[model samples]
Target: MTRRTMVFLAGFVAVAIFILGSIFYTKPAPDFAQGIGPGGDSVLVRPHSPILGPETANVTVTEFFDPMCETCREFFPLVEEIIGDHQGKVRVVLRYATFHPGSEDAVRILEAARRQNKFESVLFVLLEKQSEWAAHGEPNIARAWELAGEAGLDLPKAKTDALSPEVDRVIQQDLADAKSAGVSKTPTFFVNGKPLLSFGKQQLYDMVLAEVGQ
Candidate 1:
């Protein structure tokens, strides 16, 4: 081949390589909804209502929990202690996820109590004695009603309200919210809009104190 022709061919090859490299090297478009389901950082932005503690507290602790979960039953006291220690400085929100079929009725009953402004007391009693009602065999609503009665709630009304459409909607919304927030496990906690993977009471307290500048 002629030298000029060879040079032109080489230049063309170089330009093609440059163009392809630039196309490949260009940054990809960002996914605005990435990492948001069962395993993602975007789970923290979802909104949930506070179930305990002061509403105006500086630190918001959101717990995605299952009523029939044994681990959640164990963690209840630790959480209660934390709330007691913090007093008005922390807000605790419980997002009920009905992971087990057994949890459905209990969740509905609790939702009903919530309508009557007796949810906190009822929830505390339920969690404290979860093993009794959540044991093997068919769950006993009568036992649950008795527990509610002990908690100063109107057992008959609570039972009726538990079967209402409003309770069903609340449970459905809780499940949908959990899916949107990427929650897969029970007793997942979020502190000030961030997931808490590992931390003890002191660590949690320090983190909250730092956030509050106390």
Candidate 2:
């Protein structure tokens, strides 16, 4: 073959290889609508995650929440309503995203509360009094602890537990999983492994309804 023709053929072959490689190797865009995208279902729910419904429930609503996030607080009741609406057919798994300054401490307290079987109560109290303790620039973590106490968490024991390595690990794992699952925003909901790409109460409800086949 002529030198010029050989050079051109080699260049064409390289270009063809590059194009084919990209087509075959490039990861496809995750189908968030399916709830089980590139991240898979394992990242969606963990055994340590706090579950709010029957374990055997057909539909699982996984929410990545930051304790100090106002949107998360607002959506708490809406999620509850969804569970109630579906009765035993739906469940919720709460995962910490701790995106705020004092949120890590808040989640520490929440983990402690979970150990004491006061997760829901402490969670509600924290959300209700979020404004008081979760100030924008300077959060009053002490007040948050006090509110947790009021919610039935034994302050002393909880304080000790909150500082445990296990709690820290949980927070770290949750954050890692959140990132892997493409959850950059608090109160991100995934119904039956399908993501609510659009943030809205009605949208989440619809996702749940569709997952539940209702």
Alpha-carbon runs more than 4 Å astray in model 1: 1-50, 136-138, 199-210
The collision pairs in model 2 are: 35-193, 35-194
Q: Give a tens-digit lDDT track for model 2, residues 112-185.
A: 99889999999989998899899887889999999998888899999999999999999999999899889888
Write model 1 residue lDDT over 137-198, tens digit each, in one string: 56666677678779988877888899988777767777887786668888777677665656
lDDT of 1 at 12: 100
Shift of residue 192 alpha carbon in model 1, Å:
1.0
